[model samples]
Target: MSTSLVVGGSGRTGRRVVERLLAAGRPVAVLSRRPRPAAGVRTIVGDLDDPATWPAALADVDGVVVCVGPPHDAAGAETVVHRGVAALAAAAAERDLRVVLVSQIYVTRPQAHPAMAHVTEARARGEQALRASGADPAVVRPGWLTDEPATGVRLEQGDTGWPTALAALTPDAVAGSL
Candidate 1:
């Protein structure tokens, strides 16, 4: 990759991905609402839900990684996750850039928790939009991610009760994932 745009790149998972991408000699640009102290990466202050921000964010980008966190409110979640991701998918398809979406495991069981159901549903919808957009994006739904060191990876299908605890997304792990 030449230049990769990491949405929500100041977050724990995104930070690690940015680091790994930078270390690999690929320039990285981060589109985030909050400003972070990152030296090499270009940090663009913007919201993923806003369409206007994407023009500048994707201007010099080759690949994209959507690590966006949904808002607590139902409407905000829908706008950010569903609408934001759909916009991202459309942009990626137009530019022929592959996307790597970082989603959570709870998205599978959106109804499992009534309180946070909206967030899960929104992310699930985003995943659906990406799939339907024909962007051929890679979606990684990790369970209980942590900032610690990584163990390994195991593929499973619609897993329900596995990984009750946190799994780490260290730089090495993030490099492997990217």
Candidate 2:
């Protein structure tokens, strides 16, 4: 991909993705409701919740990487995660661009944990939207994020296990997986 719009590039996970993309000598841009990237990276400050806010054909943009979600504001759960991502996915699909969406482990089992209820329900919808939108998204499912040093890496598919990794898997490692 020539240029990929990174959602939540200012946040921990997306920041790591942006840094790695830049280090690889790739052109990087971010789509955010607000905030900007470091110098040299293009920043598109817009809220995805607004359908009209989606930018079109800027700099031959070819892909997207979404790393935005909870530890988020529960109030904006539906708008930000589901509706917004769905719209963005549709836009990307229309352009034939691939999308890499960073989702969480609890999405499949929505009511399993009360603490993540909001995120669970919303992310489920977001995943469904990406699928239905035909963005050909690669969804990364992680668990409760901790800033502790990444001790190991593991991948399991059943969506039933420890909520997180063996040791607190750092954002850096998670980004590496991407």
Best by TM-score: 1
* Candidate No. with top lDDT: 1
Residue lDDT tens for model 2, 1-178: 5887787887878888898898988888887766554877888777767667565423477778888855455768888888888998888888888888888886777787887788778888988899989777788887657766675567776576464454435787666765
Error of 2 at 97 (Å): 0.9
Error of 1 at 28 (Å): 0.3
TM for every model, in the order presented, reads: 0.86, 0.82
Judged by whole-model lDDT over C-alpha atoms, candidate 2 comes out at 0.77
* Tens digit of per-residue lDDT, candidate 1, span 1-178: 4789999998878888899998899999999999596888888999888888878888889899989778899999999999899998888888888889998777877777789999999999999999888786998888768888865664556645344422544576656755
In model 2, the runs with Cα more than 4 Å from the true position are 56-59, 70-75, 163-178
How many steric clashes between backbone atoms does each model show?
0, 0
Q: Per-prediction RMSD in angstroms? A: 5.3, 5.0
Clashing pairs in 2: none
User: Which residue pairs clash within candidate 1?
Assistant: none
